[model samples]
Target: MTTMRQLKKRAQFLKAARGRKIVRRGFVLQAVAHNEDCDLGPALGYTVTKRVGNAPQRNRIKRRLRALSKEFAEKFDPNFNYVLIGRQEALHEPFNELKKNLARALEKIHVERSAASHAIDRKSKS
Candidate 1:
C-alpha cells in the first residue's frame, strides 16, 4: 500500500512542484504538491516518464517503486505529494538496492516524518 497516494493525471503531476527536494545520493526523487483539484486529502501520486524505457522496462521500475514504498511507508509523510522519476538504471537495479536508494533519496530530500502518514498506512493495512 502507498502512504502517499498515487497521483492521478499528467496535469496533477505537473502541478505538484512546490519545491523539488532531493533525498538520496543516487536517485533524484521529486516531490510536487498537487492543486486542490487533486482530492488526495490523504493520498499521494506518482509519475514515471517514457524516457525511462519501453513498456516492460517502465513497468518494472513502477512495480519496484510500489513494493519499495509500501515496505517503508511509515517513513514517508502521507500528506505530501511525490512523483518518482525513473533513471536509466532504475529498471535494472536490484530490489534491496532500490529500497536503499529510495531511503537515501528521502533522506537527501529532507522529507520530514509525519506521524499521521504512518498511522494512515498502519490503519490501511489493518
Candidate 2:
C-alpha cells in the first residue's frame, strides 16, 4: 500500500492554499496538482492557527487530521497535494463524522477539478 507523504515546507503549504478549497465543519481542505512530474505519492500538510486555541488544542487537531489522512490514504490522488486547516470545531466533532467529511471532501475535489478542466477545454476550443 502506498502511503501519503508529509509536506514540510512553508512554500508547499502556501502553494496548496492557492489551490481549490473545500470547507467542512471540522477543517478546510486545500488541494492542488503537482507542478512537476514525479513518482512520489500524494503529499499532505496540517495547520492549526493560534486563533483556534492553545498549543495543546492545536496539536490535538493535527493528530486527528493525521489519523483521518491515514485512513483515507488509498483514496488520495497521487498527483495532487493536500493540506488540512483545522478549525475549532474539530475538537468536539465526532471521529466518525470527521472521517465522513474527509471522504466527501476528497471526492468533491476531484469532481471540481474535472469540471474545471472541462471548462478550460471548452474555452480553448472556442
Best by lDDT: 2
Cα lDDT of candidate 1 equals 0.62
- For model 1, how does the per-residue alpha-carbon lDDT over 1-126 read when each residue is reduced to its tens digit? 433566677665665555565644324566644344333333445445787778887777777777767776766654457766666676676777888887777765543444545778999999
lDDT of 1 at 51: 75
Writing each residue's lDDT as its tens digit, candidate 2 over 1-126 gives 776789999999999999999999999999988965447789999999999999999999999999989999888999999999999999999999999999999999999999999999999999
Model 2 alpha-carbon drift over 4 Å, by segment = none
Name the lDDT value of residue 124 in candidate 2: 100
Clashing pairs in 2: none
Which 10 consecutive residues of model 2 have the lowest summed lDDT? Answer: 32-41
RMSD in order of candidates: 9.0, 1.1
Candidate 1 at residue 87, lDDT?
A: 65
Candidates' TM-scores? 0.66, 0.94
lDDT of 2 at 25: 99
Displacement of residue 96 (Cα, Å) in model 1 is 1.5
Tell me how many clashing residue pairs each candidate has: 15, 0
The 0-to-1 C-alpha lDDT of every candidate, in the order given, reads 0.62, 0.94
